[model samples]
Target chain A: MDTWEKLDIGLVMTVLGMGIVFLVLIFLSSLLGFFERLFGTRRSPAAQEPKPAAPAAAEEKPPPLPRPPSKPAPEPAPAAAAPAALRPAVVAAVMAAVSAYLQAEALALEPPVKRLPDDLSFWGRAARLDQMMARRL
Target chain B: MSIGESILRFLETMGFAAMTWQQAVMIGVACILIYLALKKGFEPLLLLPIGFGVLLGNLPLAGLMAPPVYETVIDPRTGQAVQEMKEVGGLIYYLYQGIKLGIYPPLIFLGVGAMTDFGPLIANPRSLLLGAAAQFGIFTTFIGALLLDFLPGISFSPQEAASIGIIGGADGPTAIYLTARLAPHLLGPVAVAAYSYMALVPLIQPPIMKLLTTKKEREVVMEELREVSRTERIVFPIVVTAAVSLILPAAAPLVGMLMLGNLLREAVSMQPILNRLLKTAQNELINIVTILLGVSVGATASGPLFLNPRTLGIILLGVFAFAVGTAGGVLLGKIMYRTSGGKVNPLIGSAGVSAVPMAARVSQTVGQQYNPSNFLLMHAMGPNVAGVIGSAVAAGVLLSMLG
Candidate 1:
């Protein structure tokens, strides 16, 4: 038989070559695991506590929602409403000042006989509304 | 001058004057390769240059890749003849020295390393085994080459056999490196075969991948890769370099350069200027070297050498190597799949053949065909990159034994 026929070099190489490569890679895979164990895991942002919930007191108390304005006082309603751009507090203050002024003007202009009994309640009620608005603001 | 003499003189300067039938055939082959590169888009980057080089080399009296000549010099002191070979020859001849000295391949590996991402491999290290398994093609082809010796004009020594076997690795540089060292004459066919197969990865790998895997195995959904630490990514190349170089010194140049490129790319502390310089190596240097290497390699495939039966044998064996490699990876993948209780998708095993992103992409495409939701690209990359290392190690082994 020829040397090529007699020897199974191909078979030998196949086994030997594949075997060596597999073993080396297997070693590398194991090395990766070993490295991971040696170096402790690095924590991801998601894994950490949600940053202590952004200062606990801020979380417990929410900001107050805006309230609708009370029924518009009935003198002849102004033709043009105040611009909507103003801050809520400024708008409320302006409306109160205007209401008080208008009520005083009406008291001066209206006939004394037509004035209702105990009109002092109107002033007292307005004062109470001012106090409530101040606390809310 | 006589009319006949004038005609002969005129004919001498033309390409056809000295061109052989075989040379003409090689030019045709070159044209075909060029067409494949431009139209078919078959590894155009390397094939285009190679095809042009083939045309340049085979042209009569072009002298682009002629052999170096030695001149006899009389030494006065010893009164003896000292031969001095011409240092420079043709352009392609000069470029071929890079391949001959085994320099270009390692440098190319550096570029590859800089560009490649090893996160997938790091995320799931078990993919290394699949990478290793895919190399089964190389050895099987080696055996097949030896068996085919009975055919006329197709004889290979163990060294040539080793060179041919590496083409199955589907890595162009590794094939060129091994062939240039072990069988320099065979470099052209081996390189062309290797790159051609690499380009054909999508077409070649899928059929074998599907045959070896089942529908259920293909549909297997793998868990998301864990977040690999930056420290681990940084340490990986360094650790691999130290370990592989120490163990296999023959592999040091290829492996060390690859790791160095990766380290240069990944290091957080590296200066921006230096990193940019390394990036130039990854982009510009690699492109230039690739052009030079491809053309030089193609120049070696002149008529008589390339048209031989041995070249055919090598090409055939190359395909065999790729097929067997794909099969080997899938088989191993099947084993892992069964062992892991069906968590592992066998399609990823085909990526072990090491065409890099292409092989991994083939895995993704095939897996998606079965189940569109399955994202195997990242998972497949683990083994894909692993195949690069595995083949380099295999090349080291072959060089140590045969070289």
Candidate 2:
């Protein structure tokens, strides 16, 4: 076929192709809309059953609900109190352990604690010690 | 033979001795594609395999894409001549049969259906219009490709024009499927153009979107979509398959497979056993098909056939198709915006071009730039998935007319 003839065919195809595409999608869109109306209304009553109770619960429990938020503040306080109550016992145990270490030191049963370099930070010292230990291993 | 003769024969058999300038150029093209896929991250899953396939196809004397050889043999007992297999074809040659026979594209669609969620589309069915609008790019580009025939050294027949125009659909599988049927010769350039443009969606769409809509329309924060029920999701794919297949029986392969995959995914909620099939379709099956399809399509792009004025025209027209499609969607969106009393964001309309989450994300990103609190991702997804159906339908229309 000649170029012009092909062009004419092309023009027709362009219209047909776009027309069919639009028609198909529009058909699908409308079908979906129909489904929405069909299924949507059937489920609405089940969905709406909860609506009345939600507002009634809200009205009756508004004061009670605010207390829950404030209740969390004091909840953490009891947790803190338990730790505070254990402090004296912890200190006494630590003191007893220190005395036992002192007695051993007096008897020359152990070496004195090694002083770490002042220039190194705790993390840096820990890293350096880790490297040294690794090398030794 | 003497040692010197033996050495000379070995050297002659080397790939270096057989290499042509065309083959070298193809190697360079392959490298460039590889670089784009790796460094620039342009559709790496497909492009990377395609680039390597191009490399393998162009390697001197590799014969990786060679067809099977047949030989005539005499049957001594019967004193008759018969054809026998002399040599097997190359790996890619066999794998390419899937494409040539038009099998892979629909399989890929199956995977896409499994991965996709149609709830957003069901929630806002109006998005289907945007999907249809975006298909305007395909037909417009078909005319543009035909018009290119008027130029010197660039002629496209109606079938070739149709294949070239499908690149505007911005869908890789649909483009491949249509091109394989309509214009197999144009598959390489068309696939490359379609994928490259799909990867470039962010770049191509924003300008058209900005030009079409005012800032207020872009900034329009859309309302949240209503919840879609399990029953609607289950019914959607079945209804679509029946409707589309009835209307355009030609599109049944692609649209039917896509809806089937969607049904497997959606119906799994009730059956639970179908989840295994859904998982396979979504992941393993699709991944295998993608690799095979990518390599075979790339192998078709030999240096001599690919580097031509027609390819250049196809590349140019591809961008035109994408731009026109985006504009079409946005224009329809602007209409929806007016009709809906500014409830619809025009930006989401561009997602109708069917690049999936990428196009939808672009809508969200652009919408957010205008209004930070605005979220258009879910809203845009409605049209994004709808575009897949629209493009498949458009492809069916073209195939019925041209095939």
Candidate 3:
């Protein structure tokens, strides 16, 4: 047979066959997902997907109260003294992230910041810090 | 005529084009591909039926093909209308067409994009440099193959050399697409080598990864990846595809398809629609193209031509290319480790050769052996994904020079 004719046959056969196999795979994955939804428990690969929308509010809303206090906390003060080379952007970001996570944790206590006045900025930072620390667990 | 010569003369007179012995042997070999695909599941998703189609073409008097001598078809009944065999067209003829037209290879790239994750690379942009470093093997092999100008019937100009050297990257579809474009003659051996060695990545990479990385370096635990925004993921593939296509039009089809698949995935706002569409329609796109691509590759392996000395040279060169790519990644990884001083893990360097997540997994696995607590998967993935982009870029560069 000519080259084109030969290629056409091969293409049809291959696509058809492989298509069947791929469908089987998707079918299986869906079935697996279905089973997980029913009787089985499935662990997804992604982490930190649900950031507790209310807690996130606490995170975004409050920082100034903890801020003036953290202003006096000895650690952020030492960072102020360190040389620029010693405290790179990454290191600073990491420190802030840790501090932020700690502040978030402080806000998520059992009381849930009920009636702590209109300004709950400190409580929000404490809540975010709680989530960050909880991530380790 | 003796039994052998009589069989040969009959086949020659019949215009079968190959000696009966050679035809029989190739037919048997085709059966093996089918077995590997169907039973052993060694890339059976692609190989199994490709093998059967190849066997059908090589059979005597079947006229499952246009035997070149007579425009005739005896009843070789699979009973499809096309199987009624009005004239002559071999099974191989049909399979070969998709490859020559550059159809199946690009579609295969679409599936790859759907499977890949560029998040790791973006999270660690330095890994992009590692991916670029690994591409040294591709160019190095090009020079190596070109230097083989001393061999008869086996010389490669710059473009042909670039095309052939890509076998070392261990990316089957890309290698096929490039060779089909730049050096069609070398396509058969090159594709075979690319697939086989890629399957062997689990076997090949660990040793090199072990040799190059000191145990202490392997155990370096990397910081976890920070969250990448959905917006960034959506933008990445589009940016890469548009940037690459503008520079090298030849690579656009394959690269463009891959990037689109990635975009489809990361556009989370459209996830429900995409998930439904993928489930109902496009997800199987992966298997279908693999089967078509595999058989098309196999159909090109005609007996005398397929068994020639040049094919053997390619097999040898393919191994050389794979090794060189691995070494380049490992050596550079070590350099980065030293330069970064304990902060960088040298094992990640070996993942730069674009075998995708497989190479990265090996880096992580080896790292675990040194320090059981060392977790390098996320870090290794950075270079692994970058290797994919790097190889694609390198491919574009070569096509411009040669195509």
Q: Pick the candidate with the highest TM-score.
A: 2
Top-DockQ candidate index: 2
Against the native complex, each candidate's DockQ, computed on alpha carbons, is 0.20, 0.26, 0.02
Interface RMSD of each: 9.3, 8.2, 16.5
Off by over 4 Å in 1: A1-7, A40-137, B1-7, B75-80, B84-88, B268-270
Q: On a 0 to 100 scale, what is the lDDT of residue B7 in model 1?
A: 92
Check candidate 1 and list the clashing pairs. none
Give stretches of model 2 more than 4 Å off. Answer: A41-137, B76-81
Each model's total of backbone clashes: 0, 0, 34
CA shift of B238, model 1, Å = 1.5
What candidate 3 gets wrong by more than 4 Å, as runs, is A1-137, B1-19, B32-41, B61-92, B149-154, B157-159, B280-282
Q: Give the candidates in order of DockQ, highest first.
A: 2, 1, 3
Residue-by-residue lDDT tens digits, candidate 2, B1-403: 9999999999999999999998899889889888989999899988888888888888887888999899999999998999888999998999999999989999999999999999889999999999999999999999888888777889898889999999988999999999999999888889888988899999999989999999999999776678888889988999999999999998999999999999999999999999999999999999999999999999888888888899999999999999999999999999999999999999999999999989998898889789866778899999999999999999999999989
Tens-digit lDDT string for candidate 1 (B2-104): 9999999999988888899999999999999899899988999889988888888888888889777889998899999998886547888888899999999
Question: Candidate 3, residues B1-403: lDDT per residue as tens digits?
Answer: 5899988777676635644776777788787767766776555555664576567656766655343334344545654333333355666566667777888777777777777777776555567667766666676677666666467776556556677778866677778888888887666567766766666676777887787777777777665665555665676677667766775576687778888777766764656778654442246877777776776676666567566667766777877777777877788788878888767888887787777667787777778678765667778888887666666666666665567
